[model samples]
Target: MADLFFESIEGVKKPYIDSLQRLLKQLRSPFAEGDDVGIKLHWGERGNRSFLPPDYAREIAAWLMDRGAKPFVFDTTVLYSGGRRTAQDSLNTAASHGYTAEFLECPVIIADGMDGKNVVSIPAGYKHFPTVQVCNIFEQAKGFVIFSHVKGHMVSLFGGAIKNLSMGFASRAQKQRMHSDYHPVLNKKKCTRCGLCVEICSTKAATISEPEYPKYDLKKCIGCAQCIAMCPEMALQIFWNSDMTVFQEKLVETAAAVWKKIQNKSVVINALLNITEECDCLPGKNHIIGRDLGFISGYHPVAVDEESLKKTGTDIFEKAHPGIPWQRQFTYAREIGF
Candidate 1:
């Protein structure tokens, strides 16, 4: 079992902050003095308020910096065309979300360069990808901390350390590969060419085929599934093959590869507040399914997520996104010695 740290949601005192400090201290110099450490966070989309507050990130950065480690907050640009599709836009969105250096006392770097094209490939030798296109900054960091907001997801069923590292750390191309197996298939029978898919497609993968028929270009699709969510007629369906389990396994494999690269110089902290039913990738407000449970941190990425799920008192994510087999991530992670 991994040595986990917890701060309960009890007492009048600010035990949450204390727990974070104690967790950092317990890590016991995961990075040497003057080492550059990466702090990964999901700067939530515009109109979305369920993300982990910048205050928590600031505290963590301050703690790390005070300990002589150089920490910088970062996140890769999203694959979809949204407020954070480009690096500049992402940084701007982060600032709008209060991730400014003035507030956090650290620079916010977009791991990938402008247009989300900057990438360095690493050989995972996994079942799906021979090499995963990890964002350049992740490979460049000496030590790293994944500051994840624990929430339910649409495809993977849960978003935590593994999801963060798998999709969060990858370049746009890598993200595409991971999502390739689950691309959207347009159902022509219920055709209603409202052009919602075309308007919402950030990659311009969806287009009208004239006479009210919507055509999708698979080669052009980055697989963000925005069309599926935007379709009013519910005409878009996932191309579910035998590769669904492989998708989760590939994510675990990529995460394992990243852990192997960083070795013992990494930590994962999960903020369990505002437990929403969807990932922060989507824009706008969402319904919260669970109350706050404070924060949990540990060196084991897989174990931290497992603990988070167990604390939910039920398979909340599985219930939220049925048939996703979310636990397969942990199983595969352990199988690869994560």
Candidate 2:
């Protein structure tokens, strides 16, 4: 069993800096004097209304600077199209989201290639993967810290450290493959068709074949989860991760690759405020579930995520995301040596 350090949700609104400092010290970071620490953060979209506040990040960075490590905010641009897809777009979006020099003292770099293809492979042993893409920022960093906001998802039902890294470090083509699980064959019994799915699909993967009936072409689909999120009649739903055991095992395994490479040089912090129902990558935000769980930091990504999930402890979690068990992350992680 890995050592998991935790603290309760308090002081997020006031004296956040002190709370942050307390947790960082407990984790025993690799922040030596004059180290260039990579502060990996998600700036959300160009106009997201609920991303992590810049003042908190700024305070965290300043704390590190005072402690001898030079810190700068960093994030990879999106693989899918949106506000953070391009380098120019990322900078613009960061500034728009209120991430100014007054807060973060470093520049954000897209880990994979600038085009979302630059990568080095870290061979990994998992139920689903033999190797994982190690991004440039990840490969070159002297130290890493993931400042993630815990949240629910329209697809996965939860997004934390694992999702943050998988999708975060993923290339454009990798995203297409991961989303391949969303090609759900519509259950005709549940079908009211309603034309909502066809309207939402970007590649025209969904079409109306008859009145109150819709058909899906898996080949044409890009797996955007648009039809799944827009359907009102409850007719549009797919098998969640048709091969979930392997998919999630691979998810945790990939996270392990990152953690193992960094060893004690990395820290996972969950800023459990503004807990939204969907990932920041999504175009719109939705419901909030469970009371806000506060900051948790640990050297173990698996341990940190496991600790974070236990903090939620809600019944709606499994129903919100069927067939996907967050606990499986640890089971697989342990087998693969996270």
Candidate 3:
């Protein structure tokens, strides 16, 4: 068992600042004096207010700066279409959430470049991905502090420090690989063969045969799944198995790649506030599945997540998101020593 540091909300003598300070005190920072540290956290999506508070992030930044270190809060653009799909939009969203440099007393960086192209490919040597694309920011920083807002997820069942690194640190292309389990299978009966999918496909993966039906060359396909949405006749369908297990495994392997990038210069912080039934990416009122808890920090991502689940009475996320068990993340992370 790893040494997990925690501060319960009820036991906190003071409020946010005090709890944050105590948590920080218990965890050792990998950064040294004058080193640039990246504080990796999610900037809430548009219309979503369940992200980690800016004030708490500011307190961490201030603490780092006080230790003669240079700290900046940052996150990469998301893969799916949303307000945070582009680097500029992500920065704007962060600013809207009061994560501005002036407010945090530290600069904020959009890890991936303008079009989400800025990345460094690290060979993870995993079952799914031979290599994972990590944002350039992770390479630039001497250390990282992952601030995660714990919650339930549709695929992974629970989102915490592991998901934050696997999905959060990866570039858009790498994300496509992790989610490649669901290859689009065309429903030929419903296909009108309007050549819409052929026109929309960038890789020429979907091609029209002699008559009209579109033939998919899985070899050429990068698994982008762009053509699935372009089907006008609703002909495309996904193989809906619980592919989430493999997806979650690949997700953790990517986290291993990120952990390798930073070596031991990383910290995991999980804030058990506003424990929602779903992730923050979707825009809607999150149904509270678990009561507000406190915060936990640890040097190991897996340990922190294990402890977080334990404190929340264990299996809470599993109960909230049945059929999508999140334990695979920690199990794999530990197996790989990530």
Candidate 4:
């Protein structure tokens, strides 16, 4: 079978749900009857407006059910303070976003458990990560559907299937590890002393006192970029502790490590609709950079992501997040045989 399949939402009234169904129909099921299939996705952060809707997820769950597989939607806890930092909070955020079990007809779960302690370290043998820790749900599901919303990111330049598989499946500690390469660099000229960065900082690395600009404690920072991403005045930027490409490599290493375990029984899907200037992890409205092209599905995360960038064009992400060595992700993936 071919490795890639695309279903365009253009020229259709019900583009999202209908086109996704067509794309799913073109792929062969990798699961046996009665298998537990996990549908991995990001159901938008608390106030995020650009995440893919639950209607599409419902379609995927229904498709899995029709094929005799029990499907459940899931996402892991994140490293930063937000709606998804803790498992219970993440589930509540998911439910608030209309991704409840009752609506999707399957349980919506947090893969890393309520306390974010359900994790397993897998051998990577890569240059960056000798071992990668991720959610301990690999043993629970016989098959997986990595449904990602392709969009621009502050660090990766673009978020797609590879990111969905990597950070999406990573443990909070692993997420912190991957994010440790950079810290927030404030631009005081643009800062409003709004204290948003301080408020959004998960580790209290960002602090502000009355009549003082925000101060970041590098020692306490986890490099999660929550402050950088949520800064209302665009005052914070990424300051790399090491070479910038190292961050990209770490991102690939984590994804590659997880992929090694799930590749055979998983499918990758990247939705090109709602292509935004920033990732759905951030709250508020993000600028749309592309028209609703459609959904691209494949057997490999790397391939699906590459095709998605090709369809959306790398120039779009580059313009949104300039000077990021995002190409290193692909090169590093190949270097490590990911």
Candidate 4 global Cα RMSD:
6.5
lDDT, candidates in the order shown: 0.78, 0.67, 0.79, 0.87
TM-score to true structure, per model: 0.80, 0.75, 0.84, 0.83
The residue-level lDDT of candidate 2 at 77 comes to 57
Model 4 off-target regions past 4 Å?
181-242
Per-residue CA lDDT of candidate 1, range 1-338, in tens? 44787766655244266656666676656888998999988989866778777888988898888889999999987656677767888888899989998999988888887755577888787666677777888556789988899998887887888888888988765665676654778788866788888987888888886686877888998766557644556677644335668788878887877777876788888888778999887787877888788778888788888888888754666677778866688788767677
Better of 2 and 4 by TM-score: 4
Candidate 3 residue 63 C-alpha distance from true site, Å: 0.9
Q: Is candidate 1 or candidate 2 better by lDDT?
A: 1
Predicted candidate 3 versus true structure: per-residue lDDT over 173-221, tens digit per residue: 5665677643668888989888877887788988997686888898888
Show model 1 residue runs off by greater than 4 Å.
Answer: 12-16, 182-243
| Superior candidate under lDDT, 2 versus 3 | 3
Instruction: Compare the candidates by lDDT and give the number of the best one.
Output: 4
Q: Residue 59 of model 1: what lDDT? A: 88
Off by over 4 Å in 3: 11-15, 182-216, 222-242
User: Best to worst by lDDT, what's the order?
Assistant: 4, 3, 1, 2
Q: Model 3 scores what on Cα lDDT?
A: 0.79
